[model samples]
Target chain A: MVYFDNAATSFPKPDGVYDSIMKAMKEYGANPGRSGHKLALRLGREIFETRELLAKLFNIKNPMNLIFTFNCTESLNIGIKGILNTGDHVITTSMEHNSVLRPLKVLEKEGIELTIVKGDYAGRINPKDIEKSIKKNTKLIVTTHISNLTGTIMPIEQIGRIARDNGIYYLVDAAQSAGVYHIDVEKLNIDMLAFPGHKGLLGPQGTGGLYIREGIEVKELNQGGTGSISHLLEQPDILPDRYESGTPNGPGIVGLGAGVKYILQEGLDTIRKYEEELTKHFIEEIVKIENVKVYGPLDIKEQGAVVSINIGDEDSSEISYILDENYDIEVRPGLHCVPMAHKTIETFSQGVVRFSFGPFNTHDEIELGIKAIKEISKEL
Target chain B: MVYFDNAATSFPKPDGVYDSIMKAMKEYGANPGRSGHKLALRLGREIFETRELLAKLFNIKNPMNLIFTFNCTESLNIGIKGILNTGDHVITTSMEHNSVLRPLKVLEKEGIELTIVKGDYAGRINPKDIEKSIKKNTKLIVTTHISNLTGTIMPIEQIGRIARDNGIYYLVDAAQSAGVYHIDVEKLNIDMLAFPGHKGLLGPQGTGGLYIREGIEVKELNQGGTGSISHLLEQPDILPDRYESGTPNGPGIVGLGAGVKYILQEGLDTIRKYEEELTKHFIEEIVKIENVKVYGPLDIKEQGAVVSINIGDEDSSEISYILDENYDIEVRPGLHCVPMAHKTIETFSQGVVRFSFGPFNTHDEIELGIKAIKEISKEL
Candidate 1:
């Protein structure tokens, strides 16, 4: 079966990832940082290696500042809620996933001021609009590096520059951009970055992380036994431990480290180029079909591997079902947990069938996808 | 290697658990409950099956009420912080782990009153003490089913009854008691049960759950995409969706299902009886050693598989190190993330070497642990 749901979760992760996870579980599956035994210490050391790999991937200087979370949603919650307090203003764009928008909406009810900069119909967010939305009370600016629904790569470099010049914290939701795109957190002037491991990173699920720049005091969302400062009832005042509470996914993080190692060895740019080729071929051919509407910038230069399309005003779920049942092509359909993004792209009612490509996706699969869309559109 | 660190996380989970996780990852590790494709639907169904299995194990009528979390600490944080608000009081016991205490302590600073009932030297909390601490403003009563540090089994049935009679929510931290002990939530009148999937449940480290009784309204700690009601900005007000956000640990939950399935097939009572035998043998022989001080209610009827001991006032970490390096017996040393429990057992200064047995542990391993303790005590 052809898998096109990389935006949701990457499937068939590299063989090394599976091997590393199995080895970690069978060999030293002990809880890391909780026990002091050899197995526990080994697992702890391996987990730190994962943090280091992620730090290198994101151009983070200190690995200790990076914290592993259950998923990107939890990371976004901690970064958004931990930084902004009551009466503090934050700026974000409409082309973000609910992971960013939902938390901001919740905080908005709790006395935090929020300004949502509107994105164009193609889900493109202008840094100038975001700068105009900023106010004196704006302490933070949040935006997704790439729109999950439209795959429109935002001008985060320009936005980051604006935030840095205005002395505001910039938090980037690199859900779609991480692993498949270049993200130098330091060079981008990003204060915080959240990314999921199971996405483009080719790691197992249950693994994600947040990178906090040095000296940023973000209150932890949940306080618990950090394994350090077990004597104190209060949470530890350490970097990762202050944020990470309880038993982490040990083998999962090992798998994530293996995934990063694979990416580094194979080269992130190489993977991105392959996926871009697939995306470009799929979009170029599919848009030529009759009565088909495609979303996003629809250009390899501005779009990631994700492409959203609707055939003849058909229900996105129905088209997705036909693709799954008739063509054996796996794709996600509907709002994609990004209602505002749907609104931005004018697919709030019709939704869109999202085909997200991974490194493993091939030109052959893209040809098949184009052919299936052409036939389905002609039949409609 | 003899793994006696089950309290931290169960190592070498039943073969089926590993197989199930591997199958889910390699075969159909699609994003569950996110997309409508066959792979996504299959994974979503598998995850729901896990929820059902855990519900059946816990005597929860509605599987929908069970919410999967990263770990028991996240579950406890959600249960404790979600239900209680400002001007509300919470009563907890000293035998509780920091997962329960730390969140309550944080809430205490937020104008929420916290009353920590002291446990006896054996780390046993009197039900009467918990009952007396309840005030008109008492909204919740939190307790651990079994002490992680001392293995003292508290009277949770009695405490649950007290909470029920007092019209307060009862939250049980079943980190130690979940898979082995019997927990009929309905019969015990438990309002909420938080448990670690990695501990006695024998799942991977990333999986844990909170079972909230029907009709109980608890505010979610974090909000994000629930995969249901994607059009609304407000978080979905559903049973599991309200609490579970973002892509879940699909393969991890599948592994947890395999674990609970193993428990069902093997019989929880039989597993508990085997662990009790191991505990009994280890305690009986180790207490006979000179200058060896054992903590907890030594009776298997009143304790769990965990036994904490100190050899001749020697530092617990030193003894633990010797046991690990010399004997290859893996155990947790230090406060065990339950500082108050250590203090209650009067081992606050000279911690304790904790040996927690799992279903897979054998009598031979228990004997080996006893021999190591005796040899260490004699040397001391």
Candidate 2:
């Protein structure tokens, strides 16, 4: 079977990821930082190594600034809700996934002003529009680096410049771009970047992180036994520990380290280029079909690996089912938990079927995907 | 190595746990409930099965009321902070862990009235003290089933009765007593139960759960893509979906299910009995050593599978180091992240060394641990 739902989660992670997780669990599956034994210390050190690796990958100066979370959604929630207050205003784009939008919506009910900058029909968010939305009370600018629906790469660098110039905090959700894209937080002037480990990073699920710039104080979302300052009933005011509580996913973080190591060894640009080629080929051929209405920039320069399309106003779920049942090809359909993104591209009712390419997706598989879509479009 | 940090996290989980996690990751590690594909459907079904297994264990009638969390800390935070309002009052015990105390302390500053019922010198809380502390404005009663530091088992059944009689919600932190001890939510009148999957349940790290009784309304801590409601900007008002947002620890929960299955197959009584015997032998022998002050009820019927002791006024860390370095016995020596419990037992300064046994611990290991303590006592 061919899998093309890399946007949701990347399957068939690197062999080292699986091996590292197994070894960590079988050999030293102890609670890190909670005990004083060798196994616990070893696991704790290994978890730090993973943090350092992610730090290096994301160009973070201090590893402590990166806090591991359950998923990017949690990271996004923390980044969005931690900084904004009742009177604070925030700006975001329509291209973002529900992870960023839903949190802002909830905060809106609590008197936090929200300014949603609209995107074009192709799901492209202009930095100028975001700047225009800024008010005197605007405290944050949050945008997705890559749109999960249309794969439209937002101009985060320009938006970051605007935020830095205005002294507003900038948060970039790199859920769809972390491992395969080059992101230098300092160069981009991003105060916080939230990323998932299981997608382009090729790590197992249950691993994600948020990198907060040093000296930027964001209130923690959860407080518990941080294994430090245990004598105090109050939560510790330390980096990472201030945010991370209880026992973390030790082996899962070790696997994430292996994934980052794999990416560093293979070169991020190489992996990105390979996935881009597959995406470009699939998009070029599928758009030629009679009834297919492909979405996104349709250019490798303006898009990531994700591509969405519809067949003659067909329900996205039905077409996805046909692809899965008849062609043994897997793809995601419907709104993808990003209703605003669907609305931006005028596919809220039709709900485009999304085919996302990963590092492991071969050119031959892309050809087969194009063929499957061609046949399905003809039938429709 | 003898692993006696089961209260922190259970090591060497049942072999089926590891195998099930690997199979889930390699075979069907897709985003469950996010995409409409075979792999996603398979994983979603398996996750529901785990929920059903937990519901059966806890006697929860509706499995949908159970929500998966990252750890027991998050569960406790949700259960504690979800129901309480600004003017509401809460009653808790001194035997609670930092997971319970820290969140309540945070709320105490926000106009929430908190009354901490002090436990006795034995780290045991009297149900009568809790009953006396209850006020007319009391909205919740929180307690730990077993003390993480002293292994003192609280009278949760009696406490639950008091909470029920007063129309107050009862939240049980079953961090140390989830899989080994029987927890019938309905019978105990527990409105909410918080538990860690990696502890007594013998699952992998990064998995935990909170079971909210039907009709109990608790606000969610995080909101994002729940995959159920794609169009609504608001969080879906569903049972599990409202609380569980974003990509969960898929394979981790599968391992947890395998762990619950192992407990069910081996019989909870049998597992509890074996652990109890180990605790009884270790406690009886260790208490006989001179200069060693054991903290807990010390009786098999009163205590669970945990024992804390200190040797000859020695720093608990030094003795724990000797045990790890000289005898290769793994024990935790510190406040155990429960400062109030240590203070209640009058060992706050010289924290007692904690020896927690799990299902995998044997009589031979217990004897070895006793011998190590005996030799250490002679040296002191």
Candidate 3:
């Protein structure tokens, strides 16, 4: 199958993910940390191992600092909700996916202050715009590392430095960038990092994490069963346990550890180069179509692996339907869950069609996909 | 492997669980409801199927109110954090698992009025005591349907009526009771029901759900992707989506659905009878051992499938360790994450040994287990 919807969730996970998932089920798949049985102990160790791998992957100091979540949305929710309080000010960019924008909107309605710094039409958020938006009470600044719709990488290091110099916490939502590209939390000075396990991380969809740099404390989003403190009625002040409640997705997280190992083995730099080449080639070929309008940064170097565009006279939904029914190709259509970005790029009423490429997507598949689009565009 | 720890999370799931998990993964594992794609549509249907099954099982009015969660802890967290407010009065029992207690404790410290009613020695909280504890400001009451540590079934129907008469919302933490017993949400007037997917539901470990009755609102606990309203910043105030944030545990939930199917096919009443027989026989046989003393209600019809006990001159840990290493019988030691329940039973630091039976357990296994405990008592 031609799986182009990696942004939704990477299809056909790394080879290790399947085996690890099955192994956990077959061996000792107990409710981790809830019981003192041997199986539960083994399961607990695997949960910790996954955290350690995530820590190493993200360059976190302590594995406990890594907060496991249901997905990137949960992580971002915890990160945003934990830090941004009522009467607090925050800044984010328009290029963010709905996951970032929606939470901020909720907070804004709750008497929290927010400023959405506009990214360029190319989908890149400028550090200066973010810096200028910061108010005296701005406690946190959040931006997507890569635009999910356009694949535009933000200059987050610059923003991180600005936030640091101004004594503000900088959070990067790395949903589309993690594992597909390099992210050094230390050098980036990212106060908190939110990412998906199933996306670039190649873990199962249920796994995700948040990295809070040592001291930043968020309200416990969910609290129960860390297996440590049975006496405490309230939330623990501990790192991962503070955020993580209930029995974790042990089998799913163990699979994620394998996904992390795959990334380390293959190296993110190599994958980035491959994705860049594919994006450049796909862009060069797609531009030849007479009625197609591509969005975001034109150059592959400045772009993310995703491509959002519209074929004239065709709404994104109809195009998406034709792509699946006629061409046997899969691509996400509509707002891609970011209405703000669509309105910003003037695709508000009719959302743009999104085709995101993953590491496994070959140029041959892209050729067939483009051919199908061209066939539809000719009539348009 | 005599998998005796079903209360921790039932293992060796019914055959249908694996099939459903694989089927969902192969057929409709798109990021559920995020797109208009056929796969997403199918995925959405499957998610709804699980919700419907859960609603049917609990005798709930609307399946949409059944929100998917990571585990029971998450369900309780959502239920508690969403509804409980500062200065609002809340009532819970001392027998609750940490999931319900911890979040309430946090609220307690934050100046929420909390009243902890004692369970009469059997971990059984009297409904009259609960009614007496309700203050004029009491907004909600949360209690465990079945004690996690002692397996005592609380008087939920009576408590439910009291909460209804007093105009207070009542929540039942059904972590240990879901499929092993039947619950009628409407009949009992349970405003919200929290359950673990892995236990009586017979699903994978990571899955669980919260069932909220119609016309109820809890604060949005986690805010992220609901896949329905991409334009909204805050969570949609619908049923499941309002509480369930992020990409859900699709495979685990798929397995959860299959597990529930197995329970429905066999019949919850039949399954409960099978477990009760096991619990009774196990209790009867173990009593033959000279030094054995059982905890919780001795009546099999009244309590659950769990059997907690202490043998004289033998520490629970030492007995549990010997059982696993020497006799290949698995059971949980330590505090069972319910210190208050242990205190109620006077076990305290010396936690009782727990032998929880399930649908898969056999009479021979129970005999071997009892004999092994007999040997351990002899050695002690």
Candidate 4:
């Protein structure tokens, strides 16, 4: 099947990912840091090395500042719940997926005030609107690097500057942009960045991380085992250990390292260029179809590889079902876990079918998917 | 390598588990719950079926109540943070792992009071101590089913009955006992249970879960992408989804299901009986050996398969190193991430070598391990 759910989880992980997981499973499956055996210690070193790699990739000065989490949602939650307090105002946009929106809403009930900046109908958030939404009580600004629903790349750099200038922390949800885009946290003034390793990084699901700037501390979201400070009565007031409680998903993290290595070797710019060319071809071809309305930035260079669309008189789910059963193409349906983003595009009621392209996807497959969508529209 | 760190994580999972993960990877690597397509839906159904199987194995009422997490730490955090609040009090024991103690300490700093009753030097907590510790304001009483370092099994039935009598919530950290012990949550008055699927469950490293009793609002631990209620401005106040955020580790969870099946087919009770008998024989033999001090309950029926000990005049790490480097016997040394328990046993500064056996371990292997330990003791 042609997999187009990279937004959910990229399939056919980078070649080395599964190999690394299997190798670890066989050779050093011992609990890292929990045991002192040679294999166990080796496992611990492998885990530490992966964290260091991730830190370097994200331009984080200290590797420990990166906390391994289950996925992007867990990473974002650690950041959202860690720093946001009751009565603290947060600036966000309609471009966010449920991960950010749900946590922010929960905080709202706990007395945290939230200011949601409205974005363009295609899910683009203006940096000026984000700056204008800031209140004196605002302590944080969270915006997606790219909207998952429409694939519109937000002006994260401009927003980051705004947040830093206001003495507020800036958090970029790099779930969509981490490996696909160049994110220099230090240069971007990005205080906290959360991302999923499974998507653009080409790692397996269940691997993700959060980058916490040196001076910022979020309330511990989950507390348990840090594999360090076994004698402490309280959670260690350290970097990753403070937020990461419990045994980490070590094998998955190793796969993440492999995925990152693949991306780094291939170069993000090259991958971005190929993905843009494919998406541009897709957009140009799909727009030729009658009564099909596409969402997001028309210029492929301006956005990520996500292509969302609604065909007149056809429900998104119905089309997705036909595209899957009749055609061997797999694309995600509904709001792609970002209903607010759908509302921004005025597609909340009907949702939008999403075709998220990855490096493994071929142009021929896109043609097949487009052909299937065309057939689906005709039936409707 | 002789891996005695099974309690931290059971290394070299049952061959069937490794095979199962590889099979899933090769057959249907599609992202589960991402699309309504057949492959995606089948994968999603596999995840739900795993939940049902887990509930059946544990005799739980609703499968949906079992929420997947990254590890036992995240699972315990969800159960703890979801159930308790400010001004509330919790009762636990001194033998508790850092997973419980650290979270409680953080909660205490947030104004939640707690009473940590002491465990007997053998790492046993009295049911009466738990009873006495409960206050009128107490809302939850959380304890471990089995100590990771001590191998001691608490009197869960008695404590569960006490919690039931007081109408207080009872949560069991079943990290080390889920498969090794046959526990009916309802019979144990267990209102909530948290555990890692990777350990006794024999799954991949990333799998874990938390089970909450029906009708309780488990304030979600993390927020993001629960697919449902995309239009809602708040977290979906529902079972499972309220706790499970982001995309799940499908391969890991599926592997967990496969692991549980491997146990269920063989029967957990039978496995428990075999492990108990082995533990009894090994403990009797080791206790007779000179210059060795054993930790945990003397009776195998009341403890677990792990045997923690130290040779006379030897630091635990030294013994562990010699065991691995010379004898090729794998074992864990240093504080076992539950230093609180070590303090109770008066081994706070001196960690013990921990040898934990899994079902796959044979009696001959135990005899060989015992012989190896005796030889190492001669050097000491």
Per-residue error for A114 in candidate 3, Å, reads 1.3
Which one is best on DockQ? 1
Q: Chain A only: TM-score of every candidate?
A: 0.99, 0.99, 0.97, 0.98
Checking candidate 2 for backbone clashes, the offending pairs are: none
Look at candidate 3 and tell me the lDDT of residue B372. Answer: 88
Model 1, runs deviating above 4 Å: none
Candidate 2 local lDDT, A1-380, one digit each (tens): 99999999998888999999999999999999988899999999999999999999989999999999999999999999899999999999888888899999999999999999999989998888988898999999999999999999999899999999999999999999999999999999999999998998899899999999999889998889988888999999899899999999999999999999999999999999999888888888887889889999999999999999999988999999999999888899999989998888899999989999898888888988998988887777
List the DockQ of the predictions in order. Answer: 0.89, 0.86, 0.67, 0.77
Q: Which stretches of candidate 2 lie over 4 Å from their true place?
A: none
Instruction: Enumerate the chain B TM-scores of all models.
Output: 0.99, 0.99, 0.98, 0.98
lDDT of 4 by residue, A278-372 (tens): 89999998988888889898778667899998889578988887778778788888877787777787898888888999998998998897887
Q: What are the lDDT figures for the candidates, one per model?
A: 0.93, 0.93, 0.84, 0.85
RMSD per prediction, one decimal? 0.7, 0.7, 1.6, 1.5
Task: Work out how many backbone clashes candidate 1 has.
Answer: 0
DockQ comparison, 1 vs 4, better candidate? 1
Regions of candidate 4 where Cα sits further than 4 Å from its true position: none
lDDT of 1 by residue, A72-108 (tens): 9999999999999998999998998888889899999
What is the overall TM-score of model 4 with all chains considered together?
A: 0.98
> Could you tell me the lDDT of residue A47 within candidate 1?
98
TM-score to native of every candidate shown: 0.99, 0.99, 0.97, 0.98
Query: Which tens-of-lDDT digit does each residue in B1-380 have in candidate 1?
Result: 89999988998899999999999999999999999999999999999999999999999999999999999999999999999999999999989888999999989999999999999888888899988898999999999999988899989999999999999999999999999999999999899999999888889889999999999989998999999999999999898999999989999999999999999999999999999888998888887888988999899999999999888878999999999999999998899888888878888888899999998888788888888887887887
